[model samples]
Target: MTPYEDKTIKDSLREERKKLKDMNGKDKLWYIWEYYKIPIISVFVSLFLIISIASAIYSNRFETALNCVILNSQFTSESTSPDDYFDKGFRQYINLPEDTKIEVNHSMSLSFEESAMNDFTYAELAKLSAMITSKELDVMIGRKDSIDHFGKMDGFTDLKEILSPEEYEKVKDKIYFVTSDETGQKVAAGILIDEADFEKKTGLLIDGPILSVMINSTHKDTAHDLIRYMFGL
Candidate 1:
C-alpha cells in the first residue's frame, strides 16, 4: 500500500525474475525435474523395461544360434579331438559380424547310426532331426553315411546357389554332388573332411566328414557364412 514498501517488493520480484532468466544448466535441469518429475520417471521406467526385454530376446537367440547341428561319426584320434579343433584356436581365428559360440561338444553329435560311433542319445537325435526338417537347423557336419542319408532325402541345401564365383572354384573339387530323389536334380551334398586327423587315419585325403547347410534353413545368412568357412573362406 505504501510507496516505499511497494518499491521494495517490486525490486525483490525483479531480482527473482533476473535470477530465473539467468538460470545455469544445473538450475534449469532442476526446474524441469521439479515440474515434470512424474512424466520423467515414467519415461525412464518404460525405457528400462524395453531395453530389458530386448536384451533377453537377443540373448536367447544368440545363445541358441537356432540349433546349429552336426550329426557325424564320432571322432577318435590320438593327437586331437574334433572338439579341440573347433573350439580351440577358433575365437581369435576370425572376427565375424555376429557372435557364434562355435562349440563342438553336444553341438556336433546327433545319432543317425549307433554303428557309426555316434554319441547322441536316441532322444537327442530325434529332436535334432525334427529341427532339421523344420528348417531351424543352421549347419550339419557329418560323415558319408549320414551325409548320404540326409542328402538323398533332400535334407541339405545346394551350395552352388550361395557360393560366389571364386568360392565355387575353391570348393568345386571338395564338394559332393547328389541327385535328390524328390527333385531329381543334382545339388551339393556335403564337403569332404580336410582335417589332419582324417588324413593320418587314411594316409590320404579321402571322403570323410561333410559340412552342409540345409535347403530350408531359417538362418540362411549365417549358414552361407559357415559353408564358406568350411573351405577356409
Candidate 2:
C-alpha cells in the first residue's frame, strides 16, 4: 500500500538478498553450514563408511575368497552325529548353481551293524532315494565302501509303504547311495536327490534336516527353507 511501507519492505528484501549473496560467495563448506546443514549428516556419513569397510572385509574373507557356496547341487553324508568337519566338507561339495540338484540319502534308524545301518527305520533315506530316482538327477551318497550297501538296500518296500507304488518306483534305485562308513567312523546312510524330488517325497521344497546336516552342520537355514517351501510357511 503506502509508498513508505513498500520502501521499507523493499529494503528488508534487499538486505536478505545481500546476506544470501554474501553467504554464496563464501567457501562452499560455509554455504553448506548456512543453508544446507543437516543435524545427523555426520552420523549418516559415519554409518556409510562403517558399512563400506565391513562389506570390503567380508568380501575378502577366506570363505569368500574360496568361493565356497551351494547353488543347485545335491549330495549326501551320514546324518548320525553333527560332525562340523564332515558337514563343512559336504557343504563344500554340494554348494553349486541353482540348477544343481542336491539329493541326499538319509537313514532314520541307527543300527550299528554295517548291514543293518540303513534299515527300514531310516524312512528319510528311503524317501531321498525315491526322490533321486524320480528326478533322475545324479546323486552321491554314503562313503567309499557303501556303494555296495546302497545296492543291497534298494527296494520299493519302505517307500511304497509310505508313498504311491509309482512314486516308490521312481526313486527305487536311481541314486548313487553309498555306504562309505569311512572306516566305521561315519553313520550308515544318507542319500541325495533333486529339489523337485525332495518336495515330492518329503513334501518339502528345500533340503530336509537329514540332507541339510550332511551338507553343513549350520544348514539350519536350509532346513528352514525346506520346511517353509513344503509347508507354505
Candidate 3:
C-alpha cells in the first residue's frame, strides 16, 4: 500500500487509531509505545523542568527575617496559627518589609531519655542539626535538657555577645548556664522564660521554656530584638 507523503497531524492520528483498533492488546501497546514514546517523554520532561524552575523561584521569592523553632512543645499550628500572633506581631513590632517572612515552627518534638527516643525523635534531631548547620535556625525554644544538649555542642551564641550590657544585666538572673564540652567552661547559653508572659505574647504554651540564639545565626539583631520583646527588657 502507498502511504500519504503529506499526512497532517489529524490524518496521522486517524490512521494510527484505525491501525490500533484492528490490533490485539499487546500488539496495540507495542505500536503506540514505538510511535508515541518520544512525545510522551518530552511532555514529562517539560513538566519537570517547569516545576523545578517554579519551585526555585517560589522558594527564593521571600527573604526570611527570622526562624524560630519550638521543641518538645504541646503547641500545634491547628490550635493557633503563628501568623495570627507571633509572625504578625513581630513584623509589626520590628517594622519589617512586607515581603519579609518569619517562621515559628512548633511541630518538632524530641526526648533525650533512651526509652523515649524513637524514629520520629531521631528525625527531628537530624533536621534540627541540619538547620543549625545551614544557619537557617535563629532561635530555639526548648526545656532545660533540650537546651543543654545543644549547649554542650556549643550550638548557641553567648548571651553576653548578642546582648548589650544593660540587656544582659536585666536578664542575668534568669540566664541558663551550661558547661561547654569543648571549653569546659560555664557559658550563658539560654534565657529562662519562667517570668516572661510567653504564652500570652506568642500563643504558645510550654513549661520551663528556654530561649537560645544559634551561634551562626545571620539575623542576630532580630533575634536579640525578639529576646527583649519576649522578656520585656
lDDT: which candidate is best? 3
List residue ranges in candidate 2 displaced over 4 A.
1-39, 65-89, 92-233
TM-score of 1: 0.56
lDDT tens string, model 3, 183-222?
Answer: 9999999999862466655556777999999999999999
Total residue pair clashes for candidate 1: 0
The local distance difference test score of each candidate is 0.65, 0.38, 0.86
Best by TM-score: 3
lDDT of 2 by residue, 141-227 (tens): 233233344434442112222334554355445323332334432332333445554434433333332221122222333433332
Kindly report which residue pairs in candidate 1 clash with one another. Answer: none
Worst lDDT 10-window in candidate 2: 64-73
lDDT of 1 by residue, 1-233 (tens): 88656787779779767866899989978877887799999999999999999998887775433345555444445665544444443334444324566544334454455575344466666777787767667777666766777788888878877788898888789988877888898888766667565545422232366777787877666666655544577
Better of 2 and 3 by lDDT: 3
- List the candidate numbers ranked by TM-score, top first: 3, 1, 2
Ranking by lDDT: 3, 1, 2
Query: What is the C-alpha RMSD, rounded to one decimal, of candidate 1?
Result: 13.3
Better structure of 1 and 2 per lDDT: 1
